[model samples]
Target: MVDLLKPYLDLRDAEVETDFGIDDPVVYGSRAAIESIFTNLIVNSLRAFAQDYSSGRLESAEVCFRKIIIRTKKLGDRVIITFSDSGPGIREISIDDIWIVGRSTTPKGSGLGLCIVRDTVEDMGGAIRAEAHGELGGAEFTIELPLRN
Candidate 1:
């Protein structure tokens, strides 16, 4: 999935970091849904960075790798996947309302991606949380999915 979005990543001078471990949880769900979860977040990060660049925010900011990091770890019967970026964090929208349809911080966003992400996670017996500024100093999304196969 990361490889598939290389164009977008390269356009924004960013990349993804992660190592799929042998213990990574595997849940039973639609393949497309799983793919959507990742693609949406990556695209969101790209859009956010693009906005910052156009507004001269990134150019003035300190230099960094500008990456998206995805890490997974098994905790009891669930796997916690943290997906984060190194761009300007979520802006404007409250963390509480970020997953709400039509609530968007990006100027051109349709405001539906995160909503679908929330619904899809819930439908798959998973839970998700978002942090505007997280460990990586940008938008962070932590999704916990059941370890059951």
Candidate 2:
């Protein structure tokens, strides 16, 4: 799945810098669920960044990948995945309302992506959170799932 979405994530010409910290990959969960989670996050990130660029807020005054980082790690008995983007952070006013059903700041209406993310994570006995990217000046999502043995 990552291979298929690699191109879409490429920002520096045709190259993408990815970091996977899972020393030993394990098959502990449904592959379809994992793929869906990543697909939604990545696609949404792309859309948000594009919107920010169109709004003329980027430092370059044009769309450019200053940086985007995807990191994964296995610690003790859990797997953690973090997706960070380098676009304008989520508007302050929409932060609390982002995950609420039918509360979308975008024109599309009925914002439910993050709500679904929360549900899926809970269903999988995992956890997820969204926060400001700090120095990255965007939003970051962290997903943690038990490393089933």
Candidate 3:
């Protein structure tokens, strides 16, 4: 799967960071569905933060920022992965309908990003949630999948 996202990581205008807490992991869970989840979140983050890069704001030494962060860790019997962005805090006002199929707030593509994300996670017997990006100032997605025995 790393082959798919390698190009995105090299974008001169993008800044990404990842941290994994599970080192030399046990075979606790399969990361199959994670690809879709990561793709959707990363695409959204790129779109959201593109403005800063294109507008030349990212080069300013005054403000240091990371456009995206992905992290995974094991907690008890579950594996949690989080994707966060530094765009605009999730449009909570629009979130009521965010997951509805074909509901795209932006005029870009079919607004099925979150919908697909939710479905993929649930199909794996996992759960996902959306929230304010907290200090990151954009959106945060947290997914918790049960560890496969």
- Name the 10 consecutive residues with the lowest summed lDDT in model 2: 9-18
Q: Count the backbone clashes (under 3 Å) in each candidate.
A: 0, 0, 0
Please list the C-alpha lDDT of all candidates, in the order they appear. Answer: 0.83, 0.70, 0.70
lDDT of 2 by residue, 1-149 (tens): 76888777674322234689885456356777787787777666776776676566665544656456778898778889888877676675466677788875455646777777777777788988888554467788888888778
lDDT of 1 by residue, 60-128 (tens): 455345788988887888888889988789888799989888888788788899998999999889999
Arranged by lDDT with the best first, the candidates are 1, 2, 3
Write the residue-wise lDDT of candidate 3 on 34-60 in tens digits: 677778878876765654455564665
> Local error of candidate 1 at 78, Å?
0.7
Give the TM-score of each candidate.
0.90, 0.81, 0.78
Off by over 4 Å in 3: 1-3, 24-32, 51-66
Q: Which ten contiguous residues of candidate 1 have the minimum total lDDT? A: 56-65
Cα miss at 16, model 1 (Å)? Answer: 0.9
